[model samples]
Every structure is written in C-alpha cells, then in structure tokens.
Target: MKIKTGRRVASALGGAALALGITLGTAGTANAWTADWETVDDGHGVGIYNGPSSTSGKHGFHDLYTPDEVYLICWIRGEDIANQGNVWYRTSEVYYYRIGSYNLWGNYYVYGAYVDNYYAFHHRLDECKS
Candidate 1:
C-alpha cells in the first residue's frame, strides 16, 4: 500500500514537469512587437502585411520571422495555382503552401491528399488573427 502511494506522488510530479516544459517551450520573452498577430488589409482580400508596425509595412517577412511561426491567407500572385499547387510568392519564398484545414504549425508534412475546405481553412486562421 505504501509503495503504491509513493508511485502516485512520483507520477504526479513527472506529469507536472512535462506540462511545464511544453508550455515554456512555446513562448518567448517580451518585445515591442505583439505576440498576437494581425492580418493586413491591403485591398487584396486575404493578403497580410506582416512587417513590424514600426516600419510602416516595409522590410517584412525578410527578417524577424521564425520558422515555427505560421500564418494563413488567400491571395492571387503570378500565375493561377491549381487545386493541388504548392508555390510561394514574394513572402516566405518557395516554401509557402496553400493548405486546408489541418494545422501545420509543427512542421507537418503532407502528400497526395485532396482538401475540400481551402477557403474555410483560411477563414478559420484569419479569424484567429484578430
């Protein structure tokens, strides 16, 4: 009976430590910029102006962006993309993908899957941006 009680206490401590580590890993120190992101209204529908607010929308997506950070938008650039097309325009270069639904904020790799709710996916993320 005593051994079982000891095991439960150790398990609780371990679980608490694991949760704390995950929470700390996802956050960063304070900065002038807002951790909460916003979408830019450029008359291009879902296009976002991600530059630092202090810069007046210049020199953005060029510096100060982390790879793990993700944003969603819908816009037309260069050629018209196909349903399965994955191409990058000016921002974020060739790595950008027009994804649907499933969140890829954790370096998710996708292949050979057809998504029906592309617009809905964008709308979901766009609304989250405030």
Candidate 2:
C-alpha cells in the first residue's frame, strides 16, 4: 500500500513539472503586427516623402513611383496639413536622407495620402480571415 501511494505522489509531481516547463518555454514568445500594401492612383505617381507631409522634406534618391507601383501601409494618421485635413498612411519602406552632400540610407518615414476622390490604396479584409 505504501509503494502505491509513493508512485501516485511521484506521478503527480512529474505532471506538475511538465506543465511548468511548457509554460516557461512559451512565455518569451511574442506576436508582431504585420501590415498590408496599397498602390498609387492612376495618372498620379506617389512620392515617398521623408516625413508625413509634402512640406516635411523630400528624400533625394529615388524618383516618384508610378501609379502601378505598390507600397506597404503600416499605419494611418489624421492631421491638418496642406491647407486641409488629410489622412496619411505610413508606409513600410524607409526613405533615405542627405547629410550635407552625401546621401545616407537609414530608417525614415514615408507617408501616402488616402484621399477620398482617388483610389490611392486598397485592401481585402478576407485575406486576414484564417
């Protein structure tokens, strides 16, 4: 009878240890947020600016992307600018800056306008359904 009681206690302790191990293994893992992309409107090439507005300095390297070009939309913000209230989409692509006369590529902001009169961006909610 004592042997059976000892075996049951050992088994319970082993199960508890296994559960604790599993919890600790997954504790450090995190889920990062991913974004979608949008294309430029027809006949209107979008400029990947250095900041959120047109007045906020331009990146001097790449030319304007054509209407066929697509860009990743990471986030959206609304602010009053360019004599009107505008909503801007923060793109995933980084813009470069010029230091005096040299161009340096680093992490920079590129915002695209989401005007109601133009189809500047598009996304399918069905794609996120899994």
The collision pairs in model 1 are none
Per-model TM values vs. the true structure? 0.18, 0.40
Q: Candidate 1, residues 1-130: lDDT per residue as tens digits?
A: 7544543454344335434433222322222121122222222222213221222243222222112112222122222234544321112211212221112122111111112123323433221121
Residue 49 of model 1 has an lDDT of 30
Residues 6-82 of candidate 2: C-alpha lDDT, one tens digit per residue: 43454344335434432212221111123333334444345555555677666546533332232233334434455
Task: Tell me the spans in candidate 2 whose CA falls farther than 4 Å from its real position.
Answer: 1-34, 60-70, 78-85, 94-111, 114-130
**Residue runs of model 1 more than 4 Å from their true location after superposition:** 22-130
Candidate 2 C-alpha error for residue 55, in Å = 1.4
C-alpha local distance difference test of each model? 0.24, 0.36
- Return the lDDT, model 1, position 35: 19
Error of 2 at 127 (Å): 19
